[model samples]
Target: MTTETSVDVTRIPRITHDEATAITAVENRKFGEQLRSLGPDDWIASTDCERWDVRAMAAHVVGGAAGQISPREFVRQVRTGRPIVREIGAKHWWDGMNEVQVRERSDVSTDELIAEWDTNSEKARIARNKLPKPIGRLPLLNLPEPVGRQPLTYLFDMGFTRDVWAHRMDIAAATGHPMDLDATHDGRIIADIVAEWAGYFDEPFTLELTGPAGGTFTSGSGGETVRIDALEFMMILAERTEGTGLLQHTLPL
Candidate 1:
């Protein structure tokens, strides 16, 4: 006989709409700054996402922001992404949407890419924050496997922010650029991730994550003790690097 365990969603700390908005606003600005800092050669640098160079990653980020700017744009992306998803044999429509985003921007200059990202990200932030409550409460379309189903607000608020943040880390790793990290913003984001990760197992553990964005976390009583670099722990949860024991479980960035 076998049994399976699942995350207790209720146990995870919730990020409210207001907090989500603030976090994303900061994250988007930081991401843009990182993009602008990239040298010409850095644009061609390989990231952890094997198929994408830094430019492609930035394009995808811009596309994500653009899609969020309005319902029309989001629908268009979904409609246009269908065929590409099929052609690429991708398991999800988002994969196709990402491809479309990258392909459409392939000819764009690095400067143009950064500019577009800046504009679209700002627009995206406003649109998301102003989204109708009814719509925000609705479930998302084609939710990714690791994340499962979540409200539309989840994508607009936390999901997109996390994606940009993770990509920033990827770019930094690829090009040796220093990340601007602090206790307030990055630490809060990491704490939320920790809460969710701890809930995923629904087990007791003590985790001490080190670095500016890191903190000590515990779930239930002591079951296991773990200590690791904060960013590296995120890498493990994101599956950019293999994890062992409890760390083997993954959550999409």
Candidate 2:
């Protein structure tokens, strides 16, 4: 419920390249399996995100998984967050999203969509792998959020990890598919992103978290106790699930 713009995030935690890559692989497998589980007809059905049917969603999900090269403008947006930047890719990225999107009509069989998705997803991964080493560290976003003058690597990791979890929700919402409880990158990237926002924006929210076993835990709240399920707490922070889901659960926050 809190949406303030000026936060002091100088103290937020950081993630290493090793951890991000490991978590991504874990989430991707869970999501890929979930996608593979769908019957041919199910992929063609409509979902909560309007204008994108299951097939389109599937393609978008897979396509989305493939990360983009960080543009100079994108870097600026993330750090300063002054003006919102539209997501863009290498030349014709627009055409692919708009023109190509229009060309792939529902009449296109689910099998075809699935095949294109498989192919494009591989392409996307290859594209990501080709980026510079520093960029590899960034979280991937379906639409990269703007942060000014800083490296896009941070945003990329945050966006990719969050999208992985969010899309799993999308699949579940659309098909009643059960979510892989351990599907996400343990919300590490998201937690960092939320923590960043907590500093970057003026939001009066406190996240009480349980870190990986034996992992250090820290918050800006001076170690005061706040009750909440770590995942639910993280979800609200990520703005994916309304904290309303926690009404029944005795959340510490």
- Model 1 TM-score? 0.91
Stretches off by above 4 angstroms in model 1 are: 1-13
lDDT of 1 by residue, 128-243 (tens): 88878898899864565556778888887798899999989888888988787887888778878777666656667767777887777766675777888888888888889998
Compute the lDDT of residue 9 as modeled in candidate 1: 28
Query: What is the TM-score of candidate 2?
Result: 0.56
TM-score of each: 0.91, 0.56
In model 2, the worst 10-residue window by lDDT is 244-253
lDDT of all the models against the reference?
0.81, 0.48
Instruction: Kindly report which residue pairs in candidate 1 clash with one another.
Output: none
